[model samples]
Target: MIEHPMIETDRLILRKVTLDDAKDMFDYLSDSEVVKHMGIAPYQTVEAVHEEVEWYHSILKEQTGIRWGITLKNSDKVIGSCGFLNRNGKHFRTEVGFELNKEYWGKGVAREALEAVVTFGFKHMKLERIEALIEPGNISSQNLVEKIGFVKEGLLRHYEYTCGKFDDLFIYSFLKGDKTNRKSEH
Candidate 1:
């Protein structure tokens, strides 16, 4: 089984999500603005969030992926979640995904959490490449990925079907020896 370790940053804690986190997860995930670029629709109920958390746990048990609940160092409230999705252990590659509460936007919290997650993926999970797929209209997320040193590869036509329609996506990637990954060592 893959061990899910809690990762800490200067101001945030990234740890396993629990059933108790449903309310917090639902708080942000229910926002249309937040789920706009995501594959899933805005959560309608806390029960739905509970189901989602259960799914996250199942994925961890299967060793398919790991999703960490992001919280402030001094609080138990989950402000967001970030982690590797579609992890391919044999190829040492995975897709990175994260979402933060709208209230926490523009505070650099997402960037800090992502940096720690990326570092953990490379150093602990031994990932060779971390990729991100973002909607063309999500400029904020696009900027965030680029800011973290992921190179924009190309636009994938009709890459994902979300919110009842097919959407194009931009693919960004970070390799093992990339300068940003190297700098993450410290």
Candidate 2:
């Protein structure tokens, strides 16, 4: 499989990351509050961000995974990232992850990018299902997934550890032909 290349959406241009993106990455990932629920430590330095960017850059050629920068078409500003990771078994399934700059929260940016990514997952990648494991207490993420039609299957008891404690997770999945994605292909 080739890399999951850059993809465009109605309101966004999802581009593959580069080492050049270190500054942009650090602007968001270095914040403690931003990564509190993300299960990753707050990036401690620009060099750490650079290393992450480098990892994303390398993963493309390896055909192993994908991460894209979420750039608003109108602004061309790198607002966040959304990607598929932990791929397994000829890419039959994988988990999705995303993070947005706090300022853009509640402005529909996540929904816009998510719609595009979900469509890409089904159409371009030939995925059977894409899962979004969101923290149980993260009402904001739950609402976003619901708006996009990801069914809340249930909770996984102490599913993941984040911020140094066991966290409950809401299991949301979008199988191909799921009704919640009606507006995505638009």
Top model number, TM-score:
1
State TM-scores per candidate.
Answer: 0.95, 0.88
lDDT of 2 by residue, 44-137 (tens): 8878888777666676556455788998888666778987776563757777888998888888888888887887878877888888999876
| Residue-wise C-alpha lDDT for candidate 1, range 1-186, written one tens digit per residue | 567799888899999998989999999999999998898889999998998798778878877788999999999899999988888899999999999999999999999999888988888889999999999999999999898889999999998877789999999999989888334565
Assess the local accuracy of residue 59 in candidate 2 as a C-alpha lDDT between 0 and 100.
63
Report the error of model 1 at residue 139, Å.
0.5
Model 2: residues >4 Å from true position, as ranges? 1-4, 58-64, 181-186
- The lDDT for every candidate, in the order shown, is 0.90, 0.79
Candidate 1 — which residues are off by over 4 angstroms?
181-183
Instruction: Give the backbone clash total of model 1.
Output: 0
